[model samples]
Target: MKIKNQIKLSILTMPENVPLARVTVAAFASQLEFNLDELEDIKVAVSEAVTNCLVHGYSNDRNRTVNIVCSIYDNTLEIIVEDEGVGITDVSKALQPAFSTDPERMGLGFTFMQSFMDNLEVRSEISKGTRVTMTKRPQQDLAAAASEEN
Candidate 1:
């Protein structure tokens, strides 16, 4: 798939940055003419992705850095969240509902990402890092609306 445009941001792993990540992605996604609910879904998915990076990837270190990349294509928006911290040993197990390495977590991050986006891909290696890539293709009506407004 060819990318029409892209933006990349790197921020500290502070909990506060989660909202920043969400809003930025939502703003970029707004170009696709998503409705309020669709925008909210994108924000929630971004929040989960960044939160997972902070909570599990960096273990709340706050000193680490998290990178986010947003790409725009013809009718799809792709977002990637990455962290260089302790990585997951079992990607499959982590994707399971209600499975979390930390007992305090509900382990629904991946599930939410999957539910909100059309496609989700996770890559990780022990002690290396983890990257989450998500793609959302606007519905036909939404795409038509965007073009009409243009």
Candidate 2:
């Protein structure tokens, strides 16, 4: 979506990419004084989304590239990870919590992302690859919000 505030990191779609993404997210989100939980959430969410690319997205091959962009706006942090691999066939199933194409995965990737962040979105095409946008909105708790409203 013509994203501006973002960073693209290209690497082999391997397990190591997870940590790499976590580190990158930490480095960037740290500037915002993100709490420990926030940092962990961002790292884990990014890793899961990217891992999906290496695994399901490139089930047949790993020749393509995975692009992940991180953005911050509206008091929210957004991460967009895109891969040019075999797209998801069933969007509903893939998004369902605890749904994984691979047996090893807990399918908690999306769940964790959704749990840690305020919003999550997934877009995929048959052969156009998948794009996952995870967003975390940092705001006061419901009680605080209610007080402010009053």
Candidate 3:
């Protein structure tokens, strides 16, 4: 896919910064022709990813950092959230619905990310940190879909 536009941001691993990352990515995704509901889904997915980084990845350590990259392609938006703090030891188990390491939380971060985005990929290692890549395409116009060569 040809790149249309992109934005990269690094934010502190603070709970307050979750909204900052969420709104920023949604604004960038707004460049595409996403509907209001689609935009909201994107925002929610972003919030989940960033929240995971802060709460699970960094364990609420304010000194850590989280990185976000939002890229626009011809018909899709790609968002990547990364952290350098402690990483997941079992990515498959972590991806399962309601499987949070924390007993107090609902453990639906990955679930929300998977549902809202068209594609979701997670990479992590015990001490190497985790990276989440999510992509979503705008609802296709009937004519446009018909015209595209498969």
Collision pairs in model 1: none
lDDT by residue (tens digit), candidate 1, 39-139 = 99999999999999898888889899999999998778999999988899999999999999888889898999999998999999989999999999777
Indicate the TM-score of model 3.
Answer: 0.93
lDDT of 2 by residue, 27-134 (tens): 876655467887888888887788888888887355667887787664557888899998999988987988887888788888887888778898999999899888
Worst 10 residues of 2 by lDDT: 136-145
User: Candidate 2, 136: how far from true, in Å?
Assistant: 0.7
State model 2's lDDT. Answer: 0.78
Model 1: lDDT to the true structure: 0.91
TM-scores, all candidates, are: 0.91, 0.84, 0.93
Give candidate 1 misplaced runs (Cα > 4 Å): 141-150
Which model, 1 or 2, shows the larger lDDT?
Answer: 1
Q: Rate the local accuracy (lDDT) of all candidates.
A: 0.91, 0.78, 0.91
